[model samples]
Target: MKKIRFYHTLKAKIVIIIAMVIIFALQLMGANFITQTERQLVNNFQENQKLQMNFLENSFAPFLEMHENPKDTSEDIDPEEEINALISDFSGTGITSLIVVDSSFVVIGNSDTTQQVEVGQLLNDEDVRTTILQGSASSKQIINSQLNARRWRMVEPVYSSEDSQAVIGAIVMESNIESIYEQITDITLIFLRASLIAILLSSILANMVSKAITDPIKEMQTKAKAIAEGDYSGEVTIYGNDEIGLLAQNINELSEEVETGQRRIEAERQRLDSVLSNMSEGVIATNRRGELDVANNMASQMLNLSRDELAGQNILSLLEIEEDYSLRDLVDRKEDITLNIEAEEEDALLRASFSVIQADSGYISGIVCVLRDVTEEEKVEEERKEFVSNVSHELRTPLTSMRSYIEALIDGAWKDPELAPRFLDVAQSETDRMIRMIQDLLHLSRIDAGKSELQKELIDLTALFTQVLTRFDMLLDSEEYRFKNYKIERNIINEAIFVDVDSDKIVQVLDNVMNNAIKYSPEGGKITCTMTLENNQVLITVKDEGIGIPAEDLAHIFDRFYRVDRARSRAMGGTGLGLAISREVIEQHDGEIWAESINRDGTTFYIALPYIPYEEEEWGWD
Candidate 1:
């Protein structure tokens, strides 16, 4: 997928490496061949020069001997002329110059006629003088001054044929040796051309061979790119039964495995999403960097943010715990923490349980926090503690009163007949109050535990309410409550509205409401009982002219032990469980009950019971 330079490619590398090896080999071979050829050429030329010098030495030996001995001759022989004539005869045979010098280093014969003045002069050339004095041969290569060519110069001592050791004269010869070097140069050129041709051919062949190896690899690279792009359907084409082909097969297999793994991962992700979405509690997951990686719907809702908004936010800062705790602190924490989160509508208490996501290598990868809304749970716990304390206070008040009255009777108050009777009566009254409170508590307990069962029967709801009002009317006009005058006004429907209900529980509920009305009503206040049938249900309302409940306490009126005026309700013998019990009974009957009040004006309680229309035949009363 990435762009690669030509020089960095495998094909280019192979070609370059092969080219380098060929060049090195050719250079080494060329150097050795040229060196050996030059050495051979020089040796051959030197040997040929030696033979020429020997011939010249032998020819001049007799002449030199005759001159030295002053021999009686038939004619006067000019040995120098003879030597010159002999040198002139051999001039065109690759020889540059030749000269014969006497034993005292005096030049006798010169091959170049232009320099004939030095024929009898002393040959001051150091090579010639050294050869003549030492009676040895010496040779050196030099460039010819006339022809500007390379040549070998040789000096040999002329020896006597009779006395082989005696030095007679020295012969100097210079021969052109340029043709040998020219031959070597031609060979070197041929070798260079051959090397060039070889390199060109090798490069082409190397490119071809490298292509054979690299083509499949390039295909595999393409396949890898496809895989990276989530295209696992494509497979590499195998070129041969070599390692490349094997790798291609493995790649195909890996593609299949990767596809399968991707599907499984997707399924797991969907499953996780489902679980998180359906959960009642919130869930939050953070990556190793302490950044928000996942936040479920509940989590987002609980945090008053969207999932997208929560993503990539630092966990500590997201939860507003950065100042108090760090990421490492949370990772090492073993206990659940409480977070007071400000939700969309209100503040909520959440219990956050922490867990670490760990790998097999004991590496902590991330952290998971499960958030459960515990607002209601905490409220219930507080209410429970309050309930126990209230129960103790209520029972203790009655018990303390009864104990004091009994102790007074025991402390010789029995001797005072009047005090003893009054004390005993007070003790009995306190005992009765305690018993009533306990009974109310037990009844409420049963209702809360779902152990209370309703005994149902079809009855006249309007007639039942009229009977309850009749009892309150009689109680209000009785001798005991004559001072607190109350009037009952009935607005009953005169028709029987039949409904199914537990008659006894219904009576108990109506009595509690009527008693509270009587206790709170002003003198001669009207307690109006109204019953009507609406929307296939019977609605009964008990309205009284009394000090109404406060607005804030209206919502919690049905909660156990809750009273708008706690002291007033206790003085009126109210157990505070009456309305709570009434609501439970109404709900169990699939009906409804609620209250409406205006401060200092009046209060009204309504009870609606489900109504079923029936003919007399249905109840077999026809």
Candidate 2:
């Protein structure tokens, strides 16, 4: 931890705040006490000055009357002498000066002996003149800055006894009332010294008390720092069971709880990692900023990158969807996206589903994406659609032909005897063609459903191939293919190649191949059928000297309803399902079938079945 500045520390702040409050309170109390005491003292001094000025006013009125009317003088005393005696009596009573002014502003007498020469002169004081004019008494406390002393000047107006309304003279008296201020000043100085001593003691006490509170807090702070650094090893020092001490105890308990919770969280994280690594589908998670947060093992493998490469990478760029979707678009998207990932060898199609991660406050925190491989599924769906279309087309062609012929016979063609029989025979042939196509479709459906069971028996491939060629030999002689002029050539082994197989299914496979050979062969072209044992299996091959299948179409030859040339195959009355069904039957017997062809040359299809060698005695042969 760094060193804290004194003013910035809690202890310093507490002491400073307490000192300010104490100073404010003491100043308020001292100021109020001084103001109240000064006001009361001034009031009492003013009352005493008024009483003395009233007595002087009575004593001077008789002398002032004699000066105004000398012809009716009752007593033979001098007016100035009596006024002087009255002024001199108050001189020792804290009076600084006393002056008596008769009517017309003439000074009658003076109490200060040094100012006795101004007895008959007019008084030069403006306050004395203003007091006589206004016929009112006034007092003013004046400070003589030159003399460095304070005094109170009081003025009184005297009226004659003979006529109460008549102004006789005015008395002005100055009293040294500086003692009032001296007393206040002395008390103020004492209070200031006491306040300083008190403030000094208070600061010391504040520092000590603040330390008691802050010491525990500092210890708790150190403990908190240790906890933050993953070292929850110690407890905060407790001073007492006060709020601060209770806080220390809570911090200790919290450290223990955090340690336990951290362990549980670590265990949960490990389990999640294991599950994610073993998952078949790829999983990716991103933060609110769309940066990658978690990329599981499968996700890394699927993307052909490592976890390190994915970390902190934007999710849009990582998934290669930056061009299509922004982060906000993915967050708001309602449907799954199909992504075609380009690779060096081949492209893969992955279906990505998105789920938003939301907090309890309804904030969208991130997104989780699950990727599933959907390549094979999409391919199968396309094939199924093509299969349905082909089946419909094949069935519709024969049905339409039969409907036309039958309608023609019913529309009086039967009455023409010649056209009627031909129409009926054509309809019957179309019906048979439709029936045959339907049967092939049902057989294929059974094979796809895994319901085609093979009835296995030991059979000789040599005899089976010879017998098949013999059937074709008789077929060429029949009227249907007699004009075709085809020949069947047999290249078979003399020794018997014995194998366990379903004889009926094998015969059907053979018939399908031989029919294709005869149908596609050129006129007088020879159909070479060969049978041999190779690689622990029996291989049967049929080669046709017809228009060779295109190299691109060879791979799909065994696919249902697939034709190299649909028009020619349809014109020849071929269902396009014979080779497909043949392939299925051969595959069910644990055999393989494929074709090799070149354009403008010839196509050869080979069927390889598992073969077994047996002794003649086992077969009951001579």
Candidate 3:
């Protein structure tokens, strides 16, 4: 720390200050007294010099007033000797020197005989020159610092006796102040003695005041140190209720307030922790610098990291966002923005939003992020869009065809009976296809909406299988049929295999499968229909000895509007919704329908129905 000198301490400082202030005061008082004394002495000296100069100027008045004629002889005007004699009279009166100068600053007379003298010489002194130029009496003291002697100069202007306004010359004189210096020396010794006595007296008072001030201050410091160390117990004794006393009271109150605030803050922290831990949405907070500050369990889970792992980590690194994008950019937005991020080790998509935590100054102090798992939501939205698009496409083809056919009939195709009948028939067929597609769409929609009710009833699987076979035989044996003599074989493992099912919907499902088999079967090929019991459920298979479905199309055979051979199925008067409808119907009965394909040999479709005893199954179609 700080290196404090002894003088900087309170006692030393107080003593020094008192000493300085007292010394300055005494010195000023003494200086003023000495200055007044010296001024009076100088005034007296100048007055005496003025009296002398007046006497000499009066003596030379006649010589100056009687302007000599240019033709006057030496006997008539010999005033130079009288001027020199007048200057000699003041030689022993402590007068250092006296010179009479004309208006030109040229010395005309000198008083001191022992010194060098010239009747006509320039003084080479500004004081004398100023006196001569300004024609005014001026006095100054020339103090010799080493010798402790002061020399005084008095410059007096002499006017002509005849015309007082006309200046004749000036007199410059010097005097010594050795006697005054001796008196001043004696006064200085007395003043020094008084100053020392005063200083000794002040030292005691300074010590007392310094201790009075510093004692309370040191106590306050000790109590403050305790408070700084988290100790709130202290007694601050008031000292005269001064500013320092008031400061002590404030410090005590501050300590009490700090202790109370710490407890309140702890309670608030616990409440916040409880709220954050149980929230469903992942909550994360970051400081203004975009480094992580607080995170909840859900936030850690969403980031696929532990709470410890996220500590001090930059939030930007959690998301593989676009180039030059950062968490600060998102947090600085006017409103919350959705940021797509990978969560769960980059396996799931999380839609994270950043909300700004602003201070009272309206500056962003931190960022609070809310994250939602939207992977499934995004998939569903895409599926909905695709469904709408597919439905529109499917409806448009038939609509376009119907429009064309109807226009053809209206635009004179009806005038020719053959073309008119052909166009009308095609239009009717297109309308029928549209109706079937709409019905299938409605059925599937009802199932998806969980509104489709199954009238499940008890039925014999063998009887149901035989009934389905009979319907197919009748369809093939009709008069307008194209296939000739299609061989069909039935293999029933048990005479009566009971199953709980929606009998009518199961009939529809089996019919669709058998029809599909017949459509792809080779001409006169054998179709083997078998029924067996496996795992307490009836398993039925429809194997077609025709061109089997390709391996690639097997999985998608049950998909809506999917066909192995699209062109061929369309030609066979198929709406391409049969297998899709069949799958839905089978599932409604708590059964499953799937296709097994062999590249070119044949394909078998299996149906598994849950077996329910006649006593337990619901007999009514309810």
Badly placed stretches (over 4 Å) of model 3 are: 1-280, 283-380, 613-622
Clashing residue pairs, backbone N/CA/C < 3 A, model 2: none
Model 3 Cα lDDT, one tens digit per residue, 143-260: 7555667777777777766667767777777777667777777887888899899988998899898888888877787787787777888677778778888987887788899889
For candidate 3, the clash count comes to 0
How high is the CA lDDT of each candidate model? 0.84, 0.86, 0.77
Q: Give the TM-score of candidate 2.
A: 0.44
Model 2 global lDDT (CA atoms, 0 to 1):
0.86
Give per-residue lDDT, candidate 3, residue 445.
83
Whose lDDT is greatest here?
A: 2
Clash count list over all predictions:
1, 0, 0
Better of 1 and 3 by lDDT: 1
For candidate 3, the per-residue lDDT at 541 reads: 94
Cα miss at 169, model 2 (Å)?
0.8
Model 3 poorest 10 in a row by lDDT: 64-73
Off by over 4 Å in 1: 1-282, 285-387, 620-622
Q: Over the stretch 225-324, how does candidate 2's per-residue lDDT look in tens digits?
A: 8888899897888778889989998999999999999899689768878888888899998889999878898888777779999889998887788998
User: In order, what is each prediction's RMSD in angstroms?
Assistant: 38.2, 36.5, 34.3
Lowest lDDT sum, 10 consecutive residues, model 1, at 67-76
